[model samples]
Target: SQQGEEDPQALSIQEGENATMNCSYKTSINNLQWYRQNSGRGLVHLILIRSNEREKHSGRLRVTLDTSKKSSSLLITASRAADTASYFCATYNTDKLIFGTGTRLQVFP
Candidate 1:
């Protein structure tokens, strides 16, 4: 499948702590994107890293891509309770976006 799968289907962290999640896919992709979805809300784009790039960072989030392994990882630093949400990794195909089942993160104060 072109879609990816993330580990730790769920994670819980205390406020001010860091959280990391890993994703693995089966096929190559032009680009990979990470998104956040608040409970019952639409997804909000967090960051996107191109296949040619090895790593990228945005605000408190860090993303790494390994094309050879068709895998990626996301790290959220100093997480806040407000950051509690479901995170998904999506790969860009020709005309559609393929997303993983998603990792549910809960940040507790």
Candidate 2:
């Protein structure tokens, strides 16, 4: 519906498995950020990757961006039940952050 839209509206995975979610945008972006939000809570900043960078990693999270395709993806390795939350990809457009529809991740124990 917007510039940034994520695929697989919902994702269910087993604990210790890796979960991947993708986002596609229509326009250019300065940087992309990944965030996680538990049920009924605020978003938590996970990681950020610049347009010039291909990939970035932090703890169990990995993020990749392809400016040419105007797309990005977020990967969570060794997921846990605690990782069950909503993941959103946000892109910097001018001075605003345009966020994707988000993917609901459920890590089964």
Candidate 3:
């Protein structure tokens, strides 16, 4: 499948801890993007890594992409209860945009 697949569909963590999610895709991609959805809210773009980029960071978020392995990972450090949400990875190949299932993260206070 061209769509990405996320590991450990669910995660529970305490505030100030860290959370990590992995995504693996079938085919080559132009870029990979991570997104977060808070309960019933719309998806918020987290980060994007291009084919030439190996890693990227934004605030408390870190993203890594391995084109050779067709996989990517997202890490959120010093997580908070407000971080409780669902994370998703989307891959862009040429004109197609495919998204993974998602990882549900619950951060408790």
| Candidate 2 lDDT over residue span 50-107, tens digit each | 8899999899888889899888999999999999999899887788887899999999
lDDT of 1 by residue, 36-105 (tens): 9999899999999999999999999999999998999999999999999999999976788989889999
Q: What RMSD, rounded to one decimal, does every model reach? A: 1.2, 1.0, 1.3
Task: List candidate 1 stretches off by more than 4 Å.
Answer: none
**Which candidate do you rate higher for lDDT, 1 or 3?**
1
Judged by TM-score relative to the true structure, which candidate is superior, 2 or 3? 2
- Local error of candidate 2 at residue 78 (angstroms): 0.9
In candidate 3, the residue pairs with backbone N, CA or C atoms under 3 Å apart (3 or more residues apart, or in different chains) clash, namely none
In model 3, the runs with Cα more than 4 Å from the true position are none
Report residue 69 deviation for candidate 3 (angstroms).
1.3
Error of 1 at 93 (Å): 2.7
The true-versus-predicted C-alpha distance at residue 21 of model 1, in Å, is: 0.9
